[model samples]
Target: MSFATPPGWYPDAGAPGTERWWDGTAWTAHTRPPAVVQHEPVRQPYAPQSFGPPVPLPPARGGGRTRVLAITLSGLLVLGAATTAFLLLGPDDSGTRTAPAPTTSDPAPTAPATASASATPSGEGGPDGDPAVLVDQLNGITLAVPDGWEKAKNTPDDAPTIRTAVSYDCPGTAASFCYRGTVSTRTARAGRTDPKAVAEADITAAADRAYEEDILGQRTHGGITSHKVLKAEPVAVAGRTGYLVRWQVVTAKGPGGVVQSVAFPSEAGIGTPVIVRLAFDADRPELPVSLMDTITRSIRPIGDSATSGGVGASIGP
Candidate 1:
């Protein structure tokens, strides 16, 4: 039958006992038995049918259930993808996302080490605390305190001096105590710059002060009637070339005494000249002449490692 005929089940002329299903344009293989009619029905006109190969059918329409199932599957796939992403890239327990760790090519920063109080540099105030050492900060030098000697307690702070621990009444005047040995240091006054000249010029005054008279015009060491030069020569002190002059003075009322003046360039300030004066009783067995050499050899720059005075330098005869 042609498409003008509506789609329905009709009697199959080719197979009389059964009815076949006809779509709008063509017949399908579906079939069922003919129903019984209670009375004679009107007959409709039919065109002659030819038997040919069956034609392919188009897709079915109005498939609401199939469309709904397809949509549900797509939604599940999308939800599963979102859940996977969140689990792999979520925040930590702290509620803050941590950055990726640095690779070998990118190094991490490190904090610097802290310094301790004990790490202070050497020689600043190291020797000042030693009882056997005398630190002269103004001249930037240190002297070894010899045996039986101590720092001069009565000396002014501006003046660095040391003396023998023992003292005796002055022979010429009983008003004051006389030390058997004394050593004092000071920056050179505005006079001679040459170390040798300074030493030579200071020796006479040193002798007079030690034995001749005191500042009050009293004979502290009896009376200095004569003086003799014991030694005068160039010496090295605290790594600098210097000079020293030693003199023997004869006193009137007691055994004579020896005096010495040493001058050198100071290593602390602007290379100024420094003078060290020494006085010792000649007759005292403990205050030998060689003690002067020992004390001079023990001088050193404030920060130097050498405690035996200058660089292999000697003073006095």
Candidate 2:
């Protein structure tokens, strides 16, 4: 290939402040300073010529050879340094590097803190003294009911119910006057945050849906007398804020009642508030008068007796 540098003494490519001879070919051990020009007949520097193997020049004198040796050592040192510098500072083959651009996005949602795992049971007991402990995994709650009261599973198709219990054992046995009950829990389909409001809304919706049959005289338990709200107040259940709704109803059996108790979960693990209702029909003589009170007082979140937190779902009161 063609070459730029011709046969002449030029500054050493490897060593500064020194010149190296290139006899129309390869670098030679013959080196000198720029001020020390060879004593050859001065002529124009050799022009580019046919490139081939390097043609060695005659050896230099004692002093000249020593200078060449010295320059060669220094040249090696400088050359090494240059190579290292190139590796560190040289531009990349493509171009310079740059950091990526800043980005903007919505923050990710943080999970709710884990609640205590033990459930704390609180409430008054029944005549037997040993209240019935009821744990509901679906709704994430536990409560005490009148001991021996049977838990039934007779949820309607259209109505939302997580649990059901009766005041008496009615597996298949039917009686005119029996205390039938239900536990309903619901989360707002649209993600309502206010627990108490949602719970009251649930109560209103329930009444609107079944007021005629369940509350009014449209349906009969022997014969419906009068159904009216007797108590409505704020109460805490399972360490959550909620409301207590009591409706007194008169039927053929005697003076019975329906209770709607709702509460919010500590951690909205399911991303919504919860409403729980414990409705009892105590018109039946067989059902104890204190059954409703027993269950309501003993209500708690399902877990160890120390933790209080409820799960999410929808059910009827």
Candidate 3:
């Protein structure tokens, strides 16, 4: 009989009750006696032993192709499990996956810019928390409103004016109020360009306006009777050289008043002349003769630089 098998022990045909080694392709001389068995005796008749075909013997050790195949399949299952774990977890090596940080597409918010306060304009007028100041927006100047004086209400349409706090019935007409002291300002009229000439020319008109009659032809101070010059000289007003004319006047009825006309170049306007007319009742002993000088010195250009001291010749009583 012929057989094809790997190198191992097998049953030998030529040997009885024994086994021999077949080295893969051929029979070998190596042999071993059958292993002795210890068992209970059988009660049946014995029969002759007959060998039919060569049978492979069991392996002497535990290692074989079956064991190797089992190892390979186990290795493949472990590898599959490891690959599944890798797919489930993130790249962190500590076996725990880490989450990604939050992100935003919008830009970061920024703070709003702060705004600053604007400066007051030159041509604007209002009380600067000082009740004694008179702001004149037209001429861009401020006057020190003297004690016992206030801004005049119902002023004539001809000019901006201020007057004494006290008023009484007009001597000639009881229908109106008359102030003992007044100061008015106006832009110089055309053809009266020179300061000295304008002052000289307007003195009489100023006196007439104060003591002669009102715009409605009503005698305010009983009409002027005579007048005399008190002061006529060049003086510095609001940082500009100017001329002033003061007159003491006599009236038809009540004691007459002192009137003055001051002309100067406007500090803010296009070098145009400005006129300031002042009047005070001569009968009032409370009004000082030097009050005109105080008023003239107190005139200042309006705005932040208004506090600067006036530097030049000044008017006196």
Candidate 4:
């Protein structure tokens, strides 16, 4: 006996265990065979799943609502990516915004004509040995003092005196006169420096007092403390040399004590020569600067008449 089958034929000969006939395509006569039973297959229980956050579903395969949803989701993702990129890569305006220019430390150098003077014979500058040679070589303008003119100490401090001139004392007309000289040093002028400034100051200070006394008080009508330079200036003195200097600023002590000081800088040379004139009388203060004209006229340079860089200082090492 043998079993044979045709193409596309099914084995569904019968539902229960029994002999059956087949027409190759369908089952036919059934014959009782043996008693049997069927049971369902056993399966394991499924465990719960875990995830971080809810995620949207993707479109199903083929066309319809699923396809439309897939296209819409893809477009939304692309749009979001573009927006993020634009925000991060945009140009920055903060760096290029300019601020005001910074301020300057000093004013531009002054015009040469107004500050500088003509040149004077150097003679050489202050003394290493010969007093005359020393005097001749001094900076600022040069002034010749009489061979044996009286001299006075302007300051007790022993600070080296600068530009100056020696002459007879003015306090008295006696046989032995007072020793006095107009001394000065190069110093910053009105925001600058001038060699001749000290002499100008000394003259101006005295002139100012004289003018004031003529108008307001008497020569002996004292009441001012003192006068000093408010600012220094560079100017030609006796003609040549450069000078750096300060000025005469008047100080009034209540009404009785007065000191009259005038300063003029000579050109700056090896030493800072200057001319300083002072009139101080604490006990019996002088009311006016009577010697203003005389002092101004008395100034004389020791060397060349041409003035130059007298204010340029070449002082202590």
Best by lDDT: 1
Residue-by-residue lDDT tens digits, candidate 4, 56-137? 1221235366567568767876886666565556545874523433433336333221101112233433222322222322
Q: Which stretches of candidate 1 lie above 4 Å from their native place?
A: 1-125, 156-158, 308-317
lDDT of 3 at 178: 88
Candidate 3 vs. true structure, TM-score: 0.57
**Alpha-carbon shift of residue 13 in model 4 (angstroms):** 99
lDDT of 3 by residue, 1-317 (tens): 11134443333455665544444544444444432221322111111123332333323235385467568767977886666666666567785775554433335333221100011223333343345666554454667777678776567664657788889987777888888888888767755669999999888788877888888888977888888888899999988899999999999988888999999986543345788999998867667778888898788765534452222223223
Residue 304 of model 2, lDDT score: 33
**Candidate 1 vs candidate 3: which has greater lDDT?**
1
| Candidate 2 lDDT, 1-317, residue by residue in tens | 13223444444435565544554445544444442233332222222222242233323234465568668767976886776666666777588633333444346433221111111223222111222344443244555444335434454432234333434532222332234555555444445767667766766554332222343323334444566776677776666666666665555533344556465653324345556666555545434435555445556544433423221221112
Highest-TM-score candidate: 1
lDDT of each: 0.66, 0.45, 0.64, 0.32
TM-score of 4: 0.26
Residue 273 of candidate 2: its Cα lDDT?
Answer: 58
lDDT of 3 at 196: 98
For every model shown, what is its TM-score relative to the native structure?
0.57, 0.41, 0.57, 0.26
Candidate 1 vs candidate 3: the TM-score winner is: 1
